[model samples]
Target: MFRFFIIAAEIIILIIVLRSSFVQYLFEDIQNSVSDWLVSVATLPEREELRSLKDKINIRLSPLKPYQQNYVEQITADSASVKRFYHTYCENDDINPNFTGTKRAQLCLIIKQSPVMQVAKRD
Candidate 1:
């Protein structure tokens, strides 16, 4: 009976710890880190265009200041939308077709992650 009580107490403590805000924050940080890693890996530059694309994306994303995170899920859902936007905004401005496949994929991700980019307009 004593061992049972001890085990029950440990379980209760474990549950409390799991429910704590610190645990929540830890999980959020882990998720963010994983997400960042995925984005970095997917965006790795194989060609020259990708090397400078991040800067260009930041500049484009800047105008949509006071950004919100609510749209990220919706925006990221449709890759075609991102492609159209990239072609319309990024590719047309450039004078060449030097952009690589990886670069284009990364551009789509960058815009999708942007808080202020309109997802509705794409649809």
Candidate 2:
């Protein structure tokens, strides 16, 4: 009975570890996909034109509230900061740079979501 319990405990532990690892992998894959989508959208030529149209529509439909305005400003500031940081550190670097891939993806996500930008358009 003692030996059986020991084996069962070990198997359960192993299963838990494997499940944790799989969950982590899934989360990472989702993040990467979202980051890639955001990067593509941001770089698109039509983005600016669309944004302008959106602004016009919003103006006609409903004015943004103070909270929404603040959110939009924050997002814009965050995006600018991210771009500046990337250009200064990652893009212009001559050395290995040694930045992790995960961090880069995170920065990309921040640029894409732009909480401030979303707030401006909120319903």
Q: Quick one: best TM-score, which candidate? A: 1
Worst 10 residues of 2 by lDDT: 94-103
Candidate 2 backbone collisions, by pair: 71-116, 72-116, 75-116
Q: After superposition, which runs of candidate 1 have C-alpha atoms over 4 Å from their true positions?
A: 45-49, 52-123
Clashing pairs in 1: none
C-alpha lDDT (0 to 100) for residue 117 of candidate 2: 37
TM-score of each: 0.39, 0.24
lDDT at residue 30 of model 1 (Cα atoms): 99
